[model samples]
Target: MKKNKIPYLLLMIVHLGLFVVTIIKKKDKKPLLLYYSGIGMAYVFEYVVLNIFRGYRYYPKVLKRNRLDSVFGAIVSQALIVPVSAIFITFFQLGWGWKIFFTLLYSGIEQLFIHLKVFKNRWWKTIYTLISLPFYFWLVSKWSIYLDQKPKKWIGYLTLFFTFWVNYLNINFVLVAFLKRIIFKKGWSLRKYYVNFIIAPIYGFIQSIIGVIVTLKNKKLIGLGLLHLVDQLFYRLKLIKMKKWSVYCFLPIHIVLLLVGSIFKQQMLHLMSESECSQRETKKIQSPI
Candidate 1:
């Protein structure tokens, strides 16, 4: 029993260490709410699907206390984004099926690269790029359709993109800076966050924006190639790491919030409509005088 416990404890420690390092290296914390919400919701759905819907015990199961970030995170790392993105698509009046399809597509491609050990092997990353060049072209097409509804106008598109980037940067910067200043007693500088914050997003956004532009232009191959190149570059530079958990953790909570907000919005609109109708009726009654 003691020996068996040792292995589990060691694994947990290693996982916790990885989690801590990942958190520390990350410059943003703003994504926390998004991340937690999405992943949490994913688990709830996965749970229902496996237990209630399918009538099967969740497979590939590990003991709860044995998990590093907690068993919940493990569940979330794989599933949270599904329902969350589904809700978002519903809110945006897009096809929920497409949204789910794209999310799964994105996750599959991302995981394939990670599991293939491409990141550690730069040559593999390059070779894989050349090999999958055509597929990614089709992949970005899906992304374009999925994201098209996000930005109504060019300005809105830019704004929405900028907002996402800012939010990502803010998550890392504020958390890191807070720790550095409060715990380390180090002075804060605006430039640190500004330059650092902009770098990753600029790289990622530019690459993705190009993919989107190319998809729009019907130059899918060229766009995907460029996107792949950017992905490789980021990986080679170690600028990006495949998030260990499923993006689901970030989605559910936010989806519920967005849905709740929309519900309130509908209520407000209905109330306003009623008020206007009452005013018109009142005017109609008094007009004879």
Candidate 2:
């Protein structure tokens, strides 16, 4: 293997081994889900920042400048690192000192990758990673603890907001970029950026907000179906246009996004409940007898 590939391969092996050991030791479903969810969220976040936004690129170009390379790299890198880090944070019960140590250690590793040229930063910075990495670890740790709790209805709404935002970013940024490249034989242009970053986000956020309100007030499927109708109307009004086949293709994608949003809402609510429960238990324990 090439020199650059060696680092990624070794990192994968080590992480996979650690992940397996973690699973074996814990033998619990909640942490496992939290770990996997962390991985998924990391992948999606990177897809938006690195891939869609062109914030950075991987060296040795996994698939030689193809979008598939970015996708593959995102999954492997995220799966190798984020989930394992999440497992440590969520299951290991580390104190604040240890948490800080791990956070810095992870950040240092990212710096090492930069040194090795495995990661080529475009608009991304090490400080950003330093800040966000710890936050993600903290979030996942809480999520793992709260995976079983019952959440309030408002939690569902928050989840819907996050899910829709992520899905919208994926569809409008990544998907549109890919299609423009492949079908229209176009390159990245300012217009595309404006549409993907500004227009799509605004429109998608509105649509998803409405969908969530309707779903909460009435039936889920009906509300989701209405979202599809709204999309069609956008096309009819010439706000967005695509071939009939392309529109058909995106229908399932939209549905999947909606389902993911709904499911994630439940998980978020559970996490929220877990945080509340922890606070209550602490208060009770501190009270005089």
Candidate 3:
């Protein structure tokens, strides 16, 4: 049976449109940062429910493997649509009525996808989405505020986490799933993708921390050496499998990730400085002489 991709496309297009609208309408707040961070945070939530526990399934027909396809669908809805909607509501300062509207909107869309058979539920229900979305929306709204507040400590930590997370997710997917480079043993599922994806958060921010410090301290070579030694240990312990690709081969990847994490830290700090400066200027202008 031929599956309709129009629905998936339409869903993505609408959220992307919302992102654009939010960007244009809320220029001063760095909508892009908020949008992507929301996606990363929501991605974590979906990873737990959809990937780890298998709460539901999706038939987006977007990937060859059913599991991967379902994951893709989940990403579309949870990572993109949910976050985009939250940002839209926050930027516009929409009222409770609008909040209710988006909550029901997601529930309706989930039901529609289920009816179309492009999505299915194993243990999850549309009602759960209805109940959970309000909280998620509120959280994102508050989070956006936090991201702008004096560039707080958690703000930097979060920026580092998500920036490294997104990059790590991409790099790991390519290496473990597609390139056949690294594999983590004892995956909850038989699939390596699930295993690596699940364990990423565990080592993710730690690697981010390494990346930032190593680059800042100019410890790239030693840092890479230590990580490779750890991989060698994992290999010896049968905790991970490296095929055709050796621990030596991962040096470049580590280097890239290290640089990525470090660069993200630099960029985020720069943005925070700019935000603070802007706030001070606004305050000075508003104050009477």
Task: Choose the strongest candidate by TM-score.
Answer: 3
Backbone clashes in candidate 3 total 0
Against the hidden true structure, what lDDT does model 1 obtain? 0.37
On the 0 to 100 scale, the lDDT of residue 178 in model 1 is 36
Range of the 10 consecutive residues with the lowest summed lDDT in candidate 3: 200-209
lDDT of 1 by residue, 1-289 (tens): 3332343344345545544443454313222223333333333333343323332221112333221122222233323323234333333445535655655564464355355432122223334434342343333333333332222234223323333333333333333343322011113443333333335445534643553355345564565456556656655565443334322332332333333333433333343455557667788899956
lDDT for model 3 comes to: 0.74
Better of 1 and 2 by TM-score: 2
List per-prediction Cα lDDT, in the order shown. Answer: 0.37, 0.62, 0.74
lDDT by residue (tens digit), candidate 3, 162-227:
765666655665565445677665634577666665665555555656665566566878888776
lDDT of 1 at 17: 54
C-alpha TM-score for every candidate:
0.23, 0.62, 0.81
Model 2 per-residue lDDT at 273: 67
Name the regions of candidate 3 deviating beyond 4 angstroms: 20-28, 176-181, 187-194, 212-227, 278-289
lDDT of 2 by residue, 1-289 (tens): 6787777787788888878877787764434445545655675576579645877766645554344454445556676667686786567676667667777886787788789987777888878877887788787766654454444454345445655654564565455545552112123453433333445655666676865676446466776677777777665655564544544565676677667655655555556667678778878999946
